[model samples]
Target chain A: MELFQEVILRTGFLALTWGQLVMWAVGFTLIYLAIRKGFEPLLLLPIGFGILLANIPLTPLMTPGSGLIWRFYHYGLEWEVIPPLIFLGLGAMTDFGPMIANPKTLLLGAAAQVGVYFTFFLALLLKFTVPQAAVIGIIGGADGPTTIYLASKLAPEMMGVCAVAAYSYMAMVPLIQPPVMKLLTTEAERKIVMKSLRPVSKLEKIFFPVVALFVICLIVPDAAPLMAMFMMGNLFRESGVVARLSNAAQNELMNIVTIFLGVSVGATMPAATVLQPKVIFVFILGCAAFMLATATGVLFAKFMNLFLKEKINPLIGAAGVSAVPMAARVVAKLGSEANRKNYLLMHAMGPNVAGVIGTAVAAGMFISVLAK
Target chain B: MVNLESPLSGKILEINMEVGQQVNEDDEVIIIEALKMENPVYCPATGVVKEIKVRIGDQVNEGDILAVIE
Candidate 1:
């Protein structure tokens, strides 16, 4: 009879708690969103599967010393390897041609950072600590690696939820951005097609990452780890002699790190930390941050137009919020709808890529000011 | 031959016309899905599609010929 009771107690069904159940629902929902709705499936799918793994009763998947996921989390994230590696992959694939061709669009990228500060204050008003608020504000930048990097540093406990919020908002960019974009700009402004970007010379392409590395690192030394890897990857692509290294960085190495990064981030959630009331607040604040970023980007472009001789499409400014090609495509759709003649894909890409650098700078600034 | 080139690189979500089908300029004959958004690629000029170089779900880079019109 004692052995029978022990067997019953050992079964996972008897050991299940409300928190685990809740997390399962969350995990399954994320999985459904990824598989059915196709919402950032690359990250969300692994993350959802990891959530299920960590919640299984008595599993050592995330147990500190001996667990499989624990090792991934410890080395890949806590020791700061995965996110920077992801940035390296991004840099390898990035074409800075558009941004290099029209450097003025970089101002639009800088303007989007205003939303991060504004969201930071909002989180502070709602009673989050300075470091906690800083992590929340970066969701506005819409770069998942930067968000995870900042979360890992400023508030490790909040990492899982904050990363989830960032990815969710990123997938929702099309739904959230168009209303604000339409509200702020008239049809004429959207239809006003700017001149095509000048072809950036190969020399300029080779020189960009080098110059940016020197200037940005000098200003924000705290960002050097991520900045260095990013610039290195770009040089590999542009040097025209390292196709093998560039391909590996952007493809094979990238895929391996993405799997580990997703699973490790999801493992951090478990029930104990992620079930807190603060988690919900992270999602709410993240949405507000993203919307504010989009609004500011569009508004800033209109503000810039008051001085420029050749008018720019304000829609492209919203791409400065930086979900990479996703955000740029949204702006492209909006531009074409307003006028079929507008081919804003290449143009919007300038601010879209610039936004990545802008957000990295914001994360570095936060780290410099707040991290001891 | 007038080649109907893709303006953007993306997966061909749908090819609205087949070979030997008549098409007109500005006809939204092919849809390319890039980053989960469906973008309609208009017919570049009026002609019958002599050969369809791409099919649904094929990835085509910018300037890749989707079809040849003559």
Candidate 2:
């Protein structure tokens, strides 16, 4: 009888707390979103599973030194390994042609950073420390790897929340951005049809990554790790002689690092750590950051139209939040809805890709200014 | 002889011209949807559309053969 009672005690039925149950629901919700709703399946799936693993009673998955996930978090994130490697994969897949074709769109990308800076002050007002606020503010940039990179450096405690906020907001771009874009611009501005992008030459494409690498690294050395890897991957693609290497970076290396990044991030949040008022504040601030960023981009584009003879569509400005093709697609959709014949995809892509660099630079600046 | 290939990667949104229909340079023969915008693919040369190998909603990669003309 005593043996049976001891076994029952070890089974976790009575030991499972209400907090862990809530965390399991959170994990399953992510899984459901990934599977049923098709929301970032590659990322959310692993993250959801990792969350489940984290909450299991008596499990050592997140135990200080011996747990499997702890090792991954320690070496991969704390040591500053996985996020930059993911950026390497992203670089290989990215095509700089559209951004190169319309260099002025880079301004829209820079303008979007206004949201990040704005959020920094807001987080500070909420009593988050300087480093914590900087990491939280980066959620506005809407770049996953960059957010994780900064979080791991400035405030490791917030890594999971910041990553979740960044990615979820990114997936919700279609829903979140349209309302803001519509509220900011008129029918005429949205209907404006951008001219087809000029064909970017092979030589120009080749020179872009090199010049950007040199200039950005020289100015913001703190960003060198992520920026260097990103540019090197781009150069590999543009060089045309490293097709095998580029393919591997884009497909294999990207896939591997993504798995680690998702799980490690998810594992950081046990029910105990994340079930707080602070988490809700992070999520709310994240949405605000996105809104501020989107508005800034669109407004900046409108401001630019005041000078140029050829008026660029202000809608493309919202693509500067660095969600890659997703933000650009939302811009294209809005433009199409406004004018059936308008094709703004390529134009939006200019700011879309530039936003990637813009976000990385913003992260670097935060790291330089805030991180001790 | 000429083959009309996809100039960009995207889903086929519409096939504007039927096979055996006459087409000219710059004629919008196919529309591809990418980045949430529909981009028309023009006929590369003036000729009767000899064959159409893609349908609306067919995902295609750049340089994939969509049609042929002679």
Candidate 3:
């Protein structure tokens, strides 16, 4: 009878709690969204699976040293190896031709960062520490890796929630952006078709990364690590001499780092930590940040139109939130709906790519200001 | 003689000139598409199109010869 009792005590069922059960349900929901809804599947699938593994009562998957997921989280995230490498991959894949063709769109990118500062103050009002608030505020930039990078540095405990919030908002771009975009711009503004961009010269394309790197690094040394990696990746791609390195950066390196990043980020989402009022507030503030960022971009474009001779479709301004091709595509689609003849995809790409640089700069600024 | 090559890797979406056609410098010669963006390949010099090397839907890489002009 004593032996039987020992076996019962050792079983997982004996140690299970309601919180763990709820976390399992959360994991299942994330998996369902990834599979059924196709929401950020590459990252969400691993994250969901990791959450499930971590939440199991007797599992060692998330223990300090012995746990597999914990090892991935500690080495990959805590040490801050993955996010910058992901930036390298992003730089490899990014094409700066559009931004080079039209230098003015950089303003739209800067404009989109308004939400970051707005949310910074809002988080302070909500009683988060300066560093924690800065991390939360970066969700406005709508760049997942930057958010993860900043959160891991500034507010380690809030890293998982902020990463989730940033990605969820990124995935929800199609749903969240259209309403804000429509509410902000008039039909005429949306329908306005801008002129085609001048073709950028090969020499300009080759020169851009070096010049950009020099300027950004000099201005914001704190952002140099990510900026340097990103610029180096861009240099590899544009220099056209290192196809093998560029290909590896874009494909194999990106895939490997993404897997580690997703699972490790998931491991941070234990029910005890994730199910709090602060987490909920983070989500709400995240939505607000996205909306505000979209609005500010559109507004800034409108402001620029007042001075420029050739008018731009204000819808493209919404692409400044750094959701990359998705936000740009959304602007293109909306522009087409407003006027089928207007093709805005290429034009929107200028600001879309610019937003990536802008977000990195903003994170660097925050780190410079607050982390010290 | 002028050698025409694609500036990037992509599928040839269209060829705007025929062999033996007269072309001006900077004329849009072909459309190469990569990463869902279309790039127009231009002629380097005013010349007669001597040969067309790539067809519509042909996959090309950077610096691959696409045409010969004389």
Candidate 4:
């Protein structure tokens, strides 16, 4: 009878708290979103499964030194290895042709980063510490890996929530951006058809990554690690000689790192850490950041049009959120809705690609200013 | 002999020309799909399509000979 009582007392069901049960539900919701809604399945799926594993009572999966997920989190995330590798793959896959074709769109990309600064101040007003606010503000850039990198460095405790907020907002770009974009722009602006981009020469393509690295990194030495790796991967693709290496970087390397990154990030979100009123506020601020970034991009383009001889489609400005192809596609869809004959995909890609670099630079600035 | 090569690596989606066909400069000779975008491979010089070296769905690398122009 004593043995039976001991066994019952030791079982997980007896020890599990309501907070853990709520976290499990959140995990399952992430799984459902990944599978059914197709929202960043590669990332969200592993993260969801990791959440379930981490929440299991007395599993020790998230405990220091003993758990596999914990090891992944500590070594991969805490050491800051995964996000930069993800940037490597991102660089390998990105084509800067559109951005090279229209150098002016780089300004739009810079303009969109206004959200990061704006959110930083807002988070401070909401009573977050300077470091926490800096970490939270990066959620506006809509670049998941960069956000994770900055948060892990400056505010380790906020890493999981900030990553989730950045990624969820990125996935929600199609929904969040369109409403803000529509509200900010007139039909005439949306319907503005951009002229076809000039074809970039092969030599120019080969030179861009190198020249960009030298100039940008020289200016912001803090951004060198991410920027150097990013530009190196791009040079591999553009140089056309290291195809095998580029392929590995984009496919095998990226997939393995993503699995580690997603699971580790999810493991960080145990019930005790994640189920806070602060998280909800972070999400609210994150959405505001995205909206502000989008609005700033559009408005900047409109402002620039006043000085330029050839006007740009202000809609392309909204693509400057570093959500990669999704933000650009949203701009294209909105443009087409205004004018069916208008093709804005390639044009938007210029700013879309530029946004990735812009976000990295912004993250670097935050890290240098705050973390140092 | 003038060699017409693919400017980018991709799968040959469609071959738009045949051997012995007269081609003009800037005329698309083949459509190559790379990075999910279909790029039209235009004839760089006005010439006769002497031979087609690639077929539909063949994976090509940058600067691979797609056709030989005479």
Candidate 5:
């Protein structure tokens, strides 16, 4: 009788708290957002599962070394190991041909990262300290894994909130980018069409990774882990000989790592830690950072237009966010809205890939200055 | 595994190889016009083209076999 009573008492069914329940609800909301709305299901689904597992009463999922999920969180996420692995997958999937086709798009990539620094100052103004501000500022980059990796390293306590903010904002790129893009460019600028991209030669395609490796590594050694892995993946793809390696990186290796990365990152959000005023600020600041990034890209493109004879389509500027295909599609959709015949997908891709490189460099910068 | 299949459901514009012709991987075995893209059905494996399934201007699906290599 006593054993039965003790078992019942110790069971999570008897110990549910309001806060935990609220967290469970938030987890479900994330799942719904991913499943029903189709907002980054590959990431959000695993993240939602992590949130659910972490909040279950009496579970040691996040207790470190005790629970299986907790072990995943500790060895993979907390130590900042999984993100770089995920970068390998991302690198393999990336094609730098578009960026190679139009080398000028590199400037838009650099311009987009200005928001990260600007937001870093803003977070500092909010009294989050310099390291916290750097993590917070990275939300503007709209690269979830990079933001999460940086936040986990610079300010471990802020990891839960900052990661959620970064990912949510990344998923919301379509919603957030349009308003900022519309605000920055004139109707004529939106309608302006540039000439078709010159067909990039196979030689230039091969040369790109070498130049990028040298420039990015020399300029930002901190970004080397992510950028180097990314460039290596791209090099393997472009090299035309390593079909086996590229295939593994793109399919088998990437798919395996993404599952682990998504779930472990989601597990960081414990109710006791995630539901705070600072978290709210993280979300707010993250939105501002994203908006600032989009606006910066558009405005920079406009600035460049003042000197160039051939008009550049400013809509491609918004592809400066590192969301890759999504950001590029948003640019194409917006361009179509302005003019039906405008085919901006290929054009936007140049900056879209460049933005991925840009964000990695920015993260490397933050890590160099603030990593403990 | 090598997948020697037509890219689209269109007639083969031309067949440059025969049943005994040796070809390398990614070598254009057939060309099919679909939409605006000149879809080239490349040899997925480096081997002798052992069979040709269709002549020029025959419709094909994405998985429809155009030829066999061995």
Candidate 6:
């Protein structure tokens, strides 16, 4: 009878705690949402499964050498291979034509970084260490891989919470952007019609990636790995001779990295690490950082209008965060809400792409200051 | 070298310039599309549109001549 009790006690069913059950439910919920609602399913689905695999009591999945999931985490994530590969795919898929057409948008992209730094200081006031705060604040930029890449390097312990915050905020771009956008501007400001974009030449389009690599890398060498891979991918797309490579990067490369990255990232969340007071602070600071980025973009656009004879629709300013299509779509939707005829999607894309490059450069700057 | 302008490799949705139109620099002459983004091919130099090589709904390749400027 005593031996039978010992065997029962050792079994996973008997060993499961209430907290573990709750965590399992939460993980399942995330998976459900990702599948049913399409909430970043590309990343979230794998992440949810990883979380489920990690949380089950008595599972050997993360047990040092014996765990399959744990082995994946160690190989792809700890070695810092997955994020850079994601950057390579992103580089291949991005179009620099809009940035080339209006090179001045680069300044708007640069100006948007003010929000990230400003939030960094705010995180410091809330008692986070400068490095930890810097990583947390960059979540506001709404660039998920960049956030994961930075947090993994600087404060690996904070990786799960920081990534969750970054992606959650990125997915919430439509929600978080508009209220701040409405508060900062009036009906007339939202309705402001901008001139159509000037035609960008194919030669100029081809020249942009090369020039960007030179100028941005020369200015911020620490960001070279991410920036160089991104620009090289863009070059592949623009070069007109690499259709097969470009398609592979956009589809195959993106899908593979996303699975590995999502799983490894989810596995890092070990409950104890993510349930801390500091983790809560990370989420709050992330919101402030994003709000500040959108505000800075809008304010800068308003300021630029003072210098130009022709005006730009300030709605495009909100797209200065690196959320890509989501941010650009938000800008267009807001414009249409204010005026029926406003079609600003293409116009907003110019600043949206600029925002991506700008945020990468800022990440390089942060690594230079904090990592070393 | 004779400068030739055409839509990038994609579907040409609309042709806005004719063979004899006096095309100026920056005028939208042809529309090519990919990834749901419609990109306009513009006149690179101020001149007469000597040829209209592609019609509506024709597919084009990068550097293919949609028009000639001289």
Computed on C-alphas against the true complex, the DockQ of each candidate is 0.26, 0.24, 0.06, 0.06, 0.03, 0.06
lDDT of 6 by residue, A1-372 (tens): 999999998889977766666667767877997899888888778887877776778878889877887777778777777777777788787877666767667767766778998999999999998788879878878998888878877888877778878888888998999998888888998898666566677788778888888999999998887888888888888888998988888889889888888888888776655656677788888999999999999889889989978788887888889988788888877987897446566667778888888888888888898896
Give one digit per residue, the lDDT tens place, for model 2 in A204-234: 9889998999999999989998999999999
A105-192: candidate 5 lDDT, tens digit per residue: 8889889999888999999899889988998888888888788788767887777677778778878888999998998888877887
Ranking by lDDT: 2, 1, 4, 3, 5, 6
TM-score result, candidate 4: 0.86
lDDT per residue as tens, model 1, A1-372 = 999999988889987889999999989999999999999999999899888888888877888988999999999999999999988988998889889988988988888888998999999999999999999999999989999999888899888888899999899988988998999999999998878677678999999999999999999988887888898899999988999999999999999999999999988888988888877888999988988898899999999999999999999899888799888988998999898856788788899999999999999999999998
**Deviation from native of the Cα of residue A353 in model 2, angstroms:** 0.8
Clashes of each: 0, 0, 0, 0, 2, 1
Query: How far is A355's C-alpha from truth in model 1 (Å)?
Result: 0.3
Local distance difference test scores for all models? 0.90, 0.90, 0.88, 0.88, 0.81, 0.80
Candidate of highest DockQ = 1
List TM-score (chain A only) for every prediction. Answer: 0.98, 0.98, 0.97, 0.98, 0.96, 0.95
Interface Cα RMSD per model, in Å?
3.2, 4.7, 7.5, 7.2, 11.5, 7.9
Worst 10 residues of 2 chain A by lDDT: A339-348
- Which candidate do you rate higher for DockQ, 1 or 6? 1
Candidate 5: give the clashing pairs.
Answer: B9-B60, B11-B58
Model 6, docking class: incorrect
TM-score of chain B of each: 0.94, 0.95, 0.97, 0.94, 0.86, 0.83
lDDT of 4 by residue, A1-372 (tens): 999999998889988989999999989999999999999899888888888887889777888988889999989988989988988999999999989989999999999999889999999999999999988888988999999999888998898888888888888998999998998889988888787677789999899999999998888888887898899999989999999999999999999999999998888888999988888999999999999999999999999999988999999999999998889878877887897556577788899989999999998898888876
> A220 in model 4: Cα distance from truth in Å?
1.5
- Candidate 3 per-residue lDDT over residues A95-183, each given as its tens digit: 89888978899999999999889998998999989998898889999999999999887888888888878888889998999999999
Q: What TM-score do all the candidates reach, one by one?
A: 0.88, 0.89, 0.86, 0.86, 0.83, 0.83
